[model samples]
Target: MPVEPSLRVAMTVEQCWQPAPGGSGTYIRELLRAYAELDDLSVTGISAWHRGSPPEDGPLPVPVRRVPLPRALLYRSWQQARLPRTGGADVVHASTWAVPGRRAPLVATVHDLAFRHDPQHFTPNGVAFFERGLAIVRDEAAAVVVPSSATAADCVAAGIEPERVHVVLHGVRAGAADPAGVATFRARHGLVRPYVLWAGTREPRKNLPRLVAGFSAAVRAGADLDLVLVGPDGWGDERDRLAGVSADRVRVLGRLPATDLSAAYAGAHVFCYPSVREGFGMPVSEAMAHGVPVVTSRGTSMEEVSDGAAVLVDPMDEDDIGRGIVEAIWPGAHPALAAASRARAAQLSWSRAAAQTVAVLREAAG
Candidate 1:
């Protein structure tokens, strides 16, 4: 009998310390936890030297070792000099693009090429950073993993070989939301009426201006629902957009804790995410897992994430977005859609994602 080779992986965990961890942070945490549940590979996390621990450390599945260098210098070296070698592992996974040198087989995860989709949303430096990262992955990485087919297409368009691209759907872990917490969340936030919930980092690509306008239109149409926004403030604050919207009707609760976020999901009338583009739209999947009907953008990855269970709208058109929100809100909670949402979300399992990830690691290692 022939012996199979053991798989060992070293992955980057530097994003955990970023102020706004965003979708990639959630993806990393969930994937790592799921990876721990499996025995196929031994995983080690790598981070730049830092003083404080990450905000949420429970989901880090592997022991992390800190390199002596700081983040900014380390990233620059990875892109240009390819210094600070990351060896001693069969394969190295750049969970984000802050990858190590080509000392080991590499697999890079591409969340989205949002700058390519909406260049106006990013600063020149940010766009250049992404461009540089893509060039590195397209040239050196053995495999490029993306969360959705949409992102895979973007990677191919950026000149990566189609054979090197793999689409891995993310898994959702619904929080253990207490019922009293739901009531407290509603009371604490003054969510007196049925509210449409939107969550994620408040970045421009998320299309928040249009959402604010659309929610107001929905209110004018007598949808009778407040709009609750949950997320940390990213670039381009939408305060100017909110000038047209009544203050009481739209509650920007800022970022909430995991329990409160889950409670928000559990208590919402409808979850609305009208992002113009996304890699996978984790919020859509999370909302669906919580048994909520969703309203998301059409023709983006969120549309694919919804799988026809959500009310889809034109992300560019405030009228259309408003119409979608109203339709999702007015005629009562969408029991049929909720059923389909749960059914679809059920099929997206962390265990399955972990197994598929291992298979890709094996391929890279081989």
Candidate 2:
């Protein structure tokens, strides 16, 4: 077989994956892994870090080059001005909104327009920065990749042409099934019995307080269950509200490794995600892949990603969310629904996401 011609491409991000596990980090990791397997593309990853420090190395499949700068402000300025200074690529992909000044043609992945649509979720400066940066993406990027159709619609709503945005869904990495890992994760996180899981940062848009209320109501109704939250603490006064939930009934296991996280998903009675908005709710798909039922919000990408597999509820109504949870956890309740969810999850793969992304990059280069 003849090898496909390789396109030299540079992928840029704010941080490296070796030391973190946020959404952006996960996105970069999957993207790199997918690109590395492509015979038709040679990819190099660039990131912003400190100067004079040796670049951190990892087991990434693609070549990585870190450009050190003094601070985030300086790094942003450098990215806008100096990235074009050392260019030898057919295209540059901005994994997180910072584009090089005059480099090769660019493709940007705009995960969400949350900062614009829900300004209350972010700081004033952060909202302003995202608004301006997204505008740059709309005007300058050769093409913009969105994680969901909702985000693609947001791009169009923000004045970008509909033709310029592409929706490329993301997927979880495949791994070995580990029952021991599941048990260990439950024990370490104080997840005593069958419980509903909510995985995401405690942000306003996440609607954590509402979820707490819903879960609390379920427990009070004698649902012999717990609500486990897995994510780092986020900004906003809502953290206090979530903290107020009964500690015995609400377990907060902040950030776990992928292996343990997968185990947690597998061990759960059901996954409940009631966020009002999102680029895509990955946890819903992930939980379904583990053969666990899911209860998620109805609007935005939650319903789209769930794809009739999970229990859908109105996020604004605590009673509805509670009812959905009760139904999901009811023993042998929705075998057909659970089966359909697993089937849907089987259709999503990181390789497909990578292929779609590479296609966009090649098209942009042309």
Candidate 3:
């Protein structure tokens, strides 16, 4: 009798190592961490290009191979001329846009459809590249994975067959709050008492300008709360969005280390993410996981992921956002909301996401 061969899977994780902005890095890192726990599959982490050696300081669950080439070089070589370095796996998984040619089936994760829905949010060149990349995923990939049902809908709307599209919500871990770390973070950032937190890249889709306006409006409405923006600089000038807000009341505690970030989430009086759109609002779920009351945009992925645990507000309306913030931080205004948020967060976990993803891969590979 012939023995069954192992299922070799190649996963593109350059984003996990690159110093790129946004949470796609976290999504890939966390998914890989969870995948490491599974035994039935043999996974090879692939980074086709890197500025330096991939960070291997942390003990990874699987072996990683860096292709020793830059992204542009690889794109020109594989996309235009040669075969990609997919490690001869039974399946190839790309976390985002870099879907390479391979003998095995390709699985692509579509994080969001913001590029299509709001082309103005991106440069014309950027929009063109995304449209081309997504078209490739739809036309060529064996299966497409999305972080939210909203994103899945977007894919179908864009002409992807429903059967080929899978909705896999992002899993979040709610770790224990470190009081000492939280204190250090607050002191280091000089965060005043009772601050509202907003964490995301400072991009237009995040609606930072409106968020700032809402925070200011809340302040005028008798809420003495500072707004803590935790993320890296992205796309545009931060000062433009923060034009009218008093500098002292809003602190941009640019991206914190993971532990410190978790502590920031735990320490906040409330977490508000009024992004105009999202595939899955990871920060909202992260805040909910930490028992932080949340206020997020309505009719978007935030509403889908939060599942009524968060106060929904029109992201475009500063007054509505301001009201939601006021209601969130007011001592006795929404105790049950936070409790519900914690409960809802507990239901979402990376282990589950990994299991679902593995199952999807198995079906796609077969």
Question: How would you order the candidates by lDDT, starting with the best?
Answer: 1, 3, 2
Candidate 3 segments whose C-alpha is farther than 4 A from its true place:
1-5, 51-60, 78-82, 85-87
For candidate 3, write residues 1-366 as lDDT tens digits. Answer: 874356688887766665653678778778888877776778987766555554532434577776777766665555454366465788888887766667788899999989988998888977866787787788778899999899999999999999999988889987667889889888988885778999987778899889999989999999888899988777766546586678999888787777888889989988999999999989999999999899999999999999989989999999999999998877776688889899999988899988888878888899
Error of model 1, residue 99, in angstroms:
1.7
> What's model 3's lDDT at 113?
85
Off by over 4 Å in 1: 1-4
Q: What digit string (tens of lDDT, one per residue) describes model 2 on residues 1-366?
A: 986578888887555532444577678877887777878888887755534322233455666566555447544674455433437789988887566554689788988888887898899977866876786787788899999999999989998898889999998654545889888888887778788888876779999989989987777677888888887777798667885456888877877666777887888888899998999887777788887788999987989988878889999999898898888877777676678778989988889999999889999999
Judged by whole-model lDDT over C-alpha atoms, candidate 1 comes out at 0.86
lDDT-best of 2 and 3: 3
- Cα displacement (angstroms), candidate 2, residue 365, comes to 0.5
| TM-score of each prediction | 0.96, 0.91, 0.94
Clashing pairs in 1: none
| Candidate number with greatest lDDT | 1
Residue pairs in steric clash, candidate 3?
none
TM-score of 3: 0.94
Of 1 and 3, the candidate ahead on lDDT is 1
Worst 10 residues of 3 by lDDT: 51-60
